[model samples]
Target chain A: MTQARTLYDRLWDDHLVVERPDEPALVYIDLHLVHEVTSPQAFEGLRRRGLLVRRPNRTVATIDHAIPTHDRSLPIADRVAAGQIEQLKRNCTDFGVPLHGPGSGRQGIVHVIGPELGLTQPGMTVVCGDSHTATHGAFGALAFGIGTSEVEMVLATQCLLQRRSKNQRVEVTGRLRDGVTAKDLILALIARIGVDGGAGTVLEYTGSAVRALDMEARMTVCNMSIEAGARAGMIAPDDTTFQYLHGRPFAPSGRAWDEALERWRTLVTDDGASFDRSVEIDGDAIEPMITFGTNPAQAIAIGGRVPSPTDVPAADREALTKALAYMGIEPARPILGHPVQTVFIGSCTNGRLSDLRAAASVLRGRKVHPGVRTLVVPGSEDVGRAAEAEGLADIFRTAGAEWRAPGCSMCIAMNGDEVRPGETAVSTSNRNFEGRQGRGSRTLLASPLTAAAAAVTGAVADPRTFA
Target chain B: MTPFIAFESVYARLLRSHIDTDQIIPARFLKTTSREGLGRHAFADWRYEEGGQLRPDFPLHHPSARGATVLLAGENFGCGSSREHAPWALLEMGFRAVIAPSFGDIFRQNALKNGLLPIAVDAGVHAALADAPPDATVGVDLGVIRLPDGQRAFYPIDPFWKACLAGGIDEIEYVLRQAEAIADFEQGAR
Candidate 1:
């Protein structure tokens, strides 16, 4: 019998075009996702080199990261952003690469659209210029981010030269309690392992808790895999994965579906497959976590105290002190009741229909606090339309939050949405780096329920209290 | 394309960990199509004040690091974002290499293609260089990096990337040179 191989090993073996020792491995790519910000330079490089796209059909492009979510019907006011979007359209049109530009019903965040359209499938090697391409790992794919130069490489050759990563399995056991979410689970893991814990490794999040999460929740978990500094992450494909893939726009149907499913069933790690490192987390113990600093790993439970420097290991104390100073929070103080000036409820991480529903459940009959500016930005036009059809948009608007179109707004702050200086925002977006939302603005990362609760209370409050 | 002939250069250090790409070259700085002149905006947030004026307190202006061509960074340098602008900014600013205990995977890959050498040493070496004085002349010759006290530490690099640097060729040039092999492989794959 062949040696037991983990899902990562299997994907690596199958995708390997050529592997010469001590040189980067030439690997075939199944999917190449592109967006405005990183693709311009890449396409420009190809043009400069007198190259044509080797596999245009394998690439999908979208306008995100800089597109205005508030007013897409009008001309983009920012000359720089307008120019970037125009360049992307020009490049796509010139090169025959299909683009989901603004006003295309399919236009949305690249990560969200890829899976929703069934472009992401089991056992494929998917890459994008954006780091959160790890979101596609929910389907058991070997997905990761590539730099712009690599983006051009993929465009010209439909393959990338990669150094294989080791396998790390993060197994979360037990059942999740109420008020806890996939966002909380990932945040807790990052906090437990530190930011660099997953470095140089592809994390396979296994165990009962991970398997229980639906495709959307699984995407949320995998979306932040990069936040922990992992090269990529994946889950074993199963019934839940199949259910999500079924009837998707790009998914196989009829006899092809049965055959695809059979192949997908074999995508799991074998029973005795080994990982370079293994970590265990108690899923039930994870609470709605929130970061009080400039990094995603600086997190604590909703009811927990802002940790004192003395409370942490000596090596981490200095960063803790610096974080506390930047956030204007006292060490040893309870994080609850800290005032929030803005609340954001979407991104590629938490912009799915289920994420909107989760936030809407809390906002159905509640109104945001008078002091807070709240935004419920969807991840895609499809997601936005689906939310509207489900009355989620009405619920958000009735509760005093701005119901904005889908794009990566407020998350990167490159778009029109911004958290003003000195204002604290409880956001559902990934990343909490300094000036991530805006220069001199502070950020607190939370799940949808927790963000909704913060919106209503105008402070960091327990979602369970509202529940 | 300039061949990387290892040489001693001016150096400076950022004594903090997890310096992300967003911190290196913020999103606003990414508006330009041309990669030229990003060197001036390298670490713009910290190098300049909030109001867009140069801050006097920043060590970038210190006499010792004024024209520093190498950077000593804390662990996990270039942590966030897959933007290659981070390396372009560093290279444009005349940084030949960055010495750190560890680096973000994407940033490291981007640096190699752009001729910015990412030199990873042991954490102990990083600690030793943590106090590297201003006006320091660090030494790098092939795999070895020498510190202020004349201590030399070697680093491991991908042989392919090494060859590219030595030949002063980017991936495109190398890939074009292999056109026949690529065509042969494409025919087989099809």
Candidate 2:
């Protein structure tokens, strides 16, 4: 009899093209998502080697990381960024790859566009140069990030040499409390397990709490898997997954959809399957969490006090001290009521339609604090248009927040959307690393609701209090 | 990629945990299409002050760290972001290998592909090396890393990657050698 296998095992086995014992196996890739930042060197490598893209149809391109979020009507002001974007357009056109460039209506963040366009499907192996490619695993795809060389490899050949990762189950039991969110749950998990806790593993998020999350929420959870040092994160395909992908642009239609559903329904962990490492978290206990330090794992519940260096283990003291110093926060201080100069509510992590709705729920009929500057950027043009149609854009604009176009603005600090030095920003982006937003800029990672609360109050405040 | 051979050099000790790619090479320096000359900007935030003056107290600029080709770092080195520029910059800065307790998954892959070895040692060995003098030397020969404590620990690496590093073989050409197999797999998949 065949041994019971987890969803990860099935996906890995199905994608294996050539097995190499004691080494990484050759695996076929069903989708290759490319962007301007990581694709230039890769395409240059292909050109240098006289290699053509093997499967242009299976490849998709977009411009996100370095594109300006404001005023696309004018020429790109940054010459280097404009050159890179122009290079991408030329490369895509030359190689016959489809590019959703600016004005394409589908232009947006790579991870956001993939699922919204229905390119990410269950049981498919998806890869992108960006680490948040784990975001695709929300649909049960064996998706992960690759380097530029690997990107070149995948471009020349629609396959990659990859090692099979061990299975790690992050099962959250019970329902999340009111005002808690997928962002809070993920931060809580990362805080419980350190930054490198899930190294060399693929995390399969399961249990009642995970199953109850909608597609966008699940994407938020999986998007930060890399922050926990996991190679990938996955959730088994279910009705929620199916419903999200049903009418997407690239989704199968008619008989194809029926066949796809039949196959997707089988993409779950078998009973008696065991994980290499497992951790259980009580979803009911997870409150709204906010990062007080540089790494995602340096998070604590909003009501908790900043941990003193002495309170931590000796091994952790140095990191704690460094983090506290960089964040300009003293140990033993309460995280709540901490002043924030800026509030940002968007990224691959929390820039979806529901994310916008959650933020607008808190911002409706409320003006942002005069002391704080707020920016609300959508994940894609599609998301931007939908938000406009729903009046979410109006709410953000009326609430004294700048409603910008879709792109990865301020998240990477590459597109001139950045917090000034020494300024504290309560952001909805994933990472809280030093200078992540800008040089000497202090970041406090939070959920969209919490970020909106901070914008309105100009300090770190509980979203439940807003409710 | 250049072939990596057995060698020893002065090790730089920047023993901070979770040194992410952004810290290695900030996003502002990433607008260039080419991967050349990123070493100047590696650890730009830490290496320089606001006015572009080198911080004398920075680890890389310290007297002991000058000319160092090996980095003795803390756990989870090269976390966050899949920019291969992190490895490219380190290699360009003359770092041949990094010894740490742990490494970020994507960073380790990128380092290996670029001929920069990432040696993940046990806590005991890492602490021993970390406690050593800043200018002390370390050796990496094939799969084994020689610590100053006289401990020769063998690090794990895929045989294929090991050979690739040793030979500086182009991975694309190697994979293309099996085009027939890939085509067959695609046929069966369809």
DockQ score of each predicted structure, in the order shown = 0.64, 0.83
lDDT of 1 by residue, A1-467 (tens): 49999999999887777777777877788899988888888998998999999889989999889988886778889898888888989989999999988788999999999999999999898999999999999999999999999999999988888888999999999978988999999999999888889999999999889988999999999999999999998998999999999999999899999999999999999999999999999998889999998899999998999989998889888988988898888999999999999999999999999999999999989999999999999999999999999899999999999999889999998877889988999999998888888887799999999999999999999999888
Candidate 2 lDDT over residue span A72-95, tens digit each: 998999999999999999999999
Candidate 1: pairs in clash: none
Each candidate's fnat, in order?
Answer: 0.54, 0.77
Model 1 regions more than 4 Å off: B176-190
lDDT of 1 at A75: 82
Candidate 2 residues lying further than 4 Å off, grouped into runs, are B149-151
**Residue range B58-109, candidate 1, lDDT tens digits:** 7667778777788888889999899999999998888889989889989999
Give model 1's docking category: medium
Q: Whole-model Cα lDDT per candidate?
A: 0.89, 0.93
Provide backbone clash counts, one per model: 0, 0
Candidate 2's chain A scores what TM-score? 0.99
